[model samples]
Target: MTTPDVFMPRLPWDAVDPYPFYAARRREGDVVWDATAQAWLVLGHKVARNVLAAPHWISDPRANQAATAGRFFTADTVAANMLFTDGPTHDRLRHAVRDVFGHSFISQLTEGVESLCKQAISTIDVDEPFDVMSQIAWPLHVAVIAAWLGLDPAQCQVLREHSPAVIRLLSGITDTDTLHVGLAATTALITEFLPAAADRRAHPRDDLLSYLATAPELSLDEVVTTAILVAVAGHETTANLLGAALIRLITPTAEGTRLADHIDPADATVLTELLRLDSPVQAAARTATADQQLAGVHIRSGESVLVCIAAANRDPHVYPAPHQFLPGRPGPSPLTFGHGAHYCLGSALARLETSTALRHILERRPVLTATPAWRDTPAIRGPHHVPARFTA
Candidate 1:
C-alpha cells in the first residue's frame, strides 16, 4: 500500500529563502500543506497558474475572516479602491485605471522614464560602495510613478516616505497607530490633489490625472483612490524588482555578465527570466470562493491561500536550474504582477521603468562590483544595503 506524505515543520528559513523549501515540497507533488501559514501551498507551474487563473480564487481580504479581523483597511479610503474588492465592483474600478495605464498610454512615457533613470544614475558615486536601493532604485521608481500620477516633486517625497508604512498596512503587517498615520497621509494628499486635477482634466490637459478626472462614469473619490493606488502599486513593486535585479547582477555568473552586455533594453524576455529567478513580490493572498480541490488538496470555502509567487517562479519542473540567476533562461513567465483579471494595471509602465533603469546602469557601469555585506530582509527580499564599486 502507498503511504501518505509526511508534512514538514514550518521554519524561519521558509520565510527567508523559500526556494529550497518549495523545491523540497514540489518533489512530493504539486501541492503541500504549509503548516506555517496553515494553507495548502501550491508549487508546480501548472498548479500555480491554475490557482492564479481560477475565478474561484478571490483577492478580497474581507472574504476571509482572519484577513479582515483586525485590519485598518476598513477605515482607510483604500477600502473604496479596487485592490480589496471583488466581482463587478473590482472590474469597474480596475477599468478606470486600466484605460489610462494601457500600453499605448505607457509607451509615451518612455522618454520621461529614461530621463528619470539617467538623472538617478548620474548622481551615484562610482568610486565607492553605495546603497543602490536608496540612491538609485527608490528615486527612479518614485519619480516615474509621481510623474505618471501628476504629483509634484514635494508631494512625491511625502508619498515615498509614507509608502512603506502604507504597503505594510496593506500587507496586514503594521501596528494600528502606524497604519492610521499612513492612511491619514494618503487620504490628505488624495483629497487635496485629486479634486483640482479632476477639474483641470474636465477642461482638458495632457497629464494622466486630467484623463482620469475626465473619464466617464468615474466619481471624484474613485479618481482619488485610483491615483493613490497607481502611485503606490506602480512604484513599490518595481522598486523591489530593481533592487532584486541589482542583487542578481552582482552575483558571480556568466549569465549575469551576458545580461549586462545586452545593449537593447527592450528585451522583455531576458528581464522576465531574471524576474522568474528572483521575484520581487513574494506572495499574495486569495480566498477560495467555494469548496475546491486544487492539485489534490481540499481547499475549504473562505480559506486564505497565500500564493507564493517567488516559490512558484522557481519550480524546477518548469524552470531548469530554477535557483540560479539565468537571465536568458526560457520558460513560462513569472507571476510578479499576478495573472488573469487582476493582472497589474501598471505592468507596462513597470516594465518600461525597470528596463530603462537597468539599461542606464549597464551602459554606465557594466562591471559593477559589490561587497559581501548585503543584507536580506524576511518580508521584502532584497539587498537592504548594496555596497557597490562601479566603473563609470
Candidate 2:
C-alpha cells in the first residue's frame, strides 16, 4: 500500500486542540507515515498499546538510525534516567524507586495530598479571574514534589524557575537559543540536586533523595539523574493534568457542569475518564529495533514511531462518541499514563493529586472567566494560564 500523504496540522503547538487533528489521522488509517512528523504515527488504541508494550521498541533516541521528531543529547544526563532507558537498564532504574511510588505508599499520602490541595485552594481569591495554573496547580504540585524530594525553599524556588526549560528538550525543538537555555537549565538542576544527594548520603533522611542516595543499585551520578527525573516529572505531569482537568470542568459546558457537580473524586474511573479526554503527555516516541509490520504498515528497523496517546485515547473503535467526556465509559484503559515497562512511575500520585485538587476546586464552584492560554512546549500540553473565579 502507498504511504498516506497527510501532514501534521500547522497550527501553533500550544493553542491548537490536537483532538481534531488526531481524529483526522485516524480516519486515514490506524498507522500512517507522517512526512511532517518524520515518523510513523500510530493513531489506533491497539496499535499504540502493542508498540508501547513490545520490548523491542526502545526509548533511547540514540538507538534510532532513522530520523525521529525530537533531538536527543548524548551528554544530557536527563537521558540516562528510566524515561529514556530500555531493557535491563530500564528495569534496574525503575525498580530502584518502584516502592516509593507504589499504590500503598501513594494511598498513605491521600490525606496529605488533600490537605495540600485545601491549603492552596484556601488562598485563591473567590471574587476575580485568578490564574488557576499559577495560583493553584503549579504551586500545589511543585510543593508536593519538592517536599517528597526533601528540598529546601531555595531549591524549590529554583525548580519552579528552571523545570519548564528542562522540559523543552522533550519537544524535539530545533531553536538554537531554546536548546542552549534548556541544556543550561538541565546543568543547573543537576548542580542543585548534587548537594541534596550528597547530604542524603552523609545523613540519610526519610525523603526520596535519601532513599535514592542509599539505593545500592545506583551510583552517585545515577542517584542525582534519577532524582532529577522524579523531581521534574513529579510535578510537571500532575500540574498539567490538573490544570487541564479544571479547565474542562469549569468551562460552563453542560457536560462539564454535570460531571463537576455530580462526579465523585473517590471513584477512580471518573479521573480516568478526565485523563482520557485531556491527556497531558500527548505522544510517546519509540524506535523500532528491528523490522516489523504494525497495523498492516511495514516498520523498518531503526525507524521512529510516534505513538499518539491523545489520538489513541479517543480512538472511535475504543471509546464511543470519542470526543465526548463520558465518565464511567466502558472501554479499555487510556494510554495516558502509557503502557508496559515505560508506564509512568508516579501514576498513583498524579491520580491522587488531580482527584484531590478537583474535589476541592469543585467544592468552591469554579467558573472560567476566560479561555485558558495553552503552553507552547512540544509534546506536553496544558494551560499556561487559566482565568477563573470561585463562586462557593
Candidate 3:
C-alpha cells in the first residue's frame, strides 16, 4: 500500500524541538482538521478553553467509537471511570476520587512525598550521572501514590512499568499492537490491585483502597478500574512532567540562566509555566455528542475532535513568547492537566510531586551529564532519559 498524503505536521515529530510545528498549526486556524489524525486539531489557547467548556464535546469514545479505538479495558468497565465519562457519571466518579484527593486531603501526603524524594535522591551518588525518570521521578511518585492507597510500593512499580501503553491509548494511538499491549498491561495492573481491594473490603482501613472498595457509589468493577486509572494517572504523567522539567529547566539556555536556580518548592506559579513548556499528555480526543460550534468551526455530531494540548500550550497569543522555555514567567495555567469537569483529579498531587522533586535537586545544583533523549512518540511528549549529576 502507498502512503497517504496526509496534512499532519510532517517534520519535527521526533525532534526535541516540536514548537515549530505547533507554531505553524496556530497560523493555520484554531480548529483545523488533520486528515492524518482523522480529528480536528484545537491549537489556540482561548479556543481550547472554549472547546473544553462546550457541553456537547464528550470524552467517551463509545459516543463515536472509531473502528480502531483502543480497548484499554473491557470498554464498558473503563468507560464508567471519570477519565472516559461525561455528565452525571463523570461527576459521581470525580466525587468519589476527589473526597480522598481534595486539596487539604492530599496536602497530608506532602510529608510522605517529600520523604520519598529524599529517599530517591539519596540512592544516587553525590556527583554521579543518574536517569532522573527511573531513579528519582518514577519510584518517588509510585511510592507516594502507593502509600496513599495503602498498598506495597514494590507492587506499584508494575503500574509504572505498564504505563507507556496507557499513555499511547489515551493519546489516540489505536494500532492493533499498541491496543493489545495496553489491554495486557491494564489487565496486569488490575490483577495486582484486585487482592488489595479484596483485603481492604475484609478489613477496612482508613485509606484510599478501603474507601474505594467499600464505597456505595462505585461498582466492584468501577473500584478495580478506578484503582488502575489512579495508579497510572497519579504517577506516570507526573514522572514525565518531572523529567521534562529537569531536562528543560536545569540545562543552561543560550541566555545562560537556568530555571532550576530560581525554583521555589512552594510556588505553583513556576510549575504552571513549566507545564506549558513541556506537557505530559500531548493530545486527546473527544467525540461530539451533538452538532455544535467550536472555535468558530461547525463541528458535526459524532465527529472526533482532537485537542492538541502541546500545541495550545504554546500558542503565541496565550504566551507572549511561546517557544522560549522560561520558568516563573507569567502565563495562565496550562491545559496539560486539562480543563473543565474532565480536568485531572490528581493535578495537585502531580504538581506536588514535581515541585518537591525539583526543589531537592535544585538545592544540590544538579548538572546535566549528557544530552537528553526524548521519547519519540507523537501522542505523549517527554524525555525518555535525563541524566544528571548534582555538583554541589
Candidate 4:
C-alpha cells in the first residue's frame, strides 16, 4: 500500500511525544479507522470508556476475525493468561485469586512496604546520579511481590534480568529477534515461579502462593501461571507507574512547595491526577464482537479497536487544563488502571506502592539534577532509567 493508503503507517511522533498526533486526530472525531494500525482508534474520554466497558468488545484478538492464525509470539505464553480471555474462562481465573486485592490483604503490607521504600531510597549514593528505575522502583516492586508470594525477596535478580523481555511480550513486539527474547522471558518467568508454587503446596503457609497452591478450584498449572501473573504483572506496571510519577514530581513547575511536598502521598486525588497526566500503560487493544456505533462511527463486527488511554485521560472536555499536572485537580477518575470487568486487579497495591515510595523520597528531600530517559515502547509509558543525583 502507498503512503496515501496508510496515511502514516507509523505515527511520526512515536519516538518522542505522540499526544499532538493524537490530539490532532481526535479533533476530527472521537473514533477513527486508522490504516496505520488497521484498527479503530478511540480517543475521546467518554467514548473510549464506553468502548472499554462495552459487552461487544473482545480482549483476545483471535476471538475477533481470526486476526492471526497463531499467537503473536509463542502459542500459549501470551494466550493462556486471563488478560486475553473473556467470559466464564476469564471469570473463573479472576475469581480464583480475587482475594489478593482485598483491603485486609493490602492493608497488612503497609509497614513492610514503607520500610522497603525507605531502604530503597537510602541505597542511592548521596553524591551521584542513581538510576531510580533500578535502585528504587524496580527492586521495591519485586521485593513486595516476592514477600507476598512466599518467595525469597533476594530472587528479584531474575525478575530484574527478565523484566524488559517479558514486557516486550505484552507491548506487541513479535519480530523474529524480539520474539526469541519474549519466548525466553516467558519461559524463565514460568520456570522460576512454577517450582516455587510446588514448594508452597508441599509446605503450606499463610501466604498468597500457598493459598493458590492449595486452592481446590485451581489446577497446578493455573497456580503456577497465576503466581507468575501476580509476581510479574503486579510489580512491573506499578513500577512503571511509580517511575513515571517520580519523574514528573521531581520537577513540578517552580511553585513554592512542589505538589509532592504539601500533598499527602496517600491521598487518592494526588495519585489520580498523576496517573491521568502520565499514565503507565498508555494504550490497549480490544476487538469488536459485533457491529456497533462508537461516537457515530460505524464499527463492523470482528474489527479491532485501540483504546488510547493516555489520549482519553487528557480529553479537554472531561478535564480542564488537561495537559498540566495539577494534583489538586478534582472530578473524573483516570483510566490508567482501566474500568469495568477487567479493571486492574493490582490497582490497590499499585497505589499503596507509589504513595509509600513518594512519601519516603520527599522525606529525604533529594534534588534530582537530571531527567530520566522514558521507555521506548509505543504502548507502555515509563522511564527505562530515572537518573537522579542525591543532594542533601
Top-lDDT structure, candidate number:
2
Residue-level error in angstroms, candidate 1, position 167: 1.5
**lDDT, candidate 3, 1-392, per-residue tens:** 22355232211244466677767776778898766566787888887877776787887655544524433345676456777788888888878778777788788888888888889897777788788877887778788878878877557667777877776666544566666777778778878888888888778998788899898888777888898788777877888888888887788978898766766756777788888888877777788878887768898988877777888898887788777756667767789988898888888788788888888878778888889888766677778888888787
Considering only N, C-alpha and C atoms within 3 Å, which residue pairs clash in candidate 1? none
lDDT of each: 0.68, 0.81, 0.76, 0.75
Clash-forming residue pairs, model 3:
none
Winner on lDDT between 1 and 2 is 2
Model 1: which ten-residue window has the lowest total lDDT? 6-15
**Ranked candidates, highest lDDT first:** 2, 3, 4, 1
- Residue 152 of model 2 has an lDDT of 94
Query: How many angstroms is residue 362 displaced in model 3 relative to the true structure, after the best TM-score fit?
Result: 1.0
Q: Using alpha carbons, what is the TM-score of model 2?
A: 0.92
What is the clash count of model 4? 0
Clashing pairs in 2: none
* All candidates in order of TM-score, best leading: 2, 3, 4, 1
* Candidate 1, 133-206: lDDT as tens digits: 78887778988877766777777877787676556545433334554666677666666666666676667667
How many steric clashes does model 2 contain?
A: 0
lDDT at 334 for candidate 2?
98
* Model 4 residue 133 CA deviation in Å: 1.2
- TM-score for predicted model 3 compared with the true structure: 0.92
Worst 10 residues of 2 by lDDT: 6-15
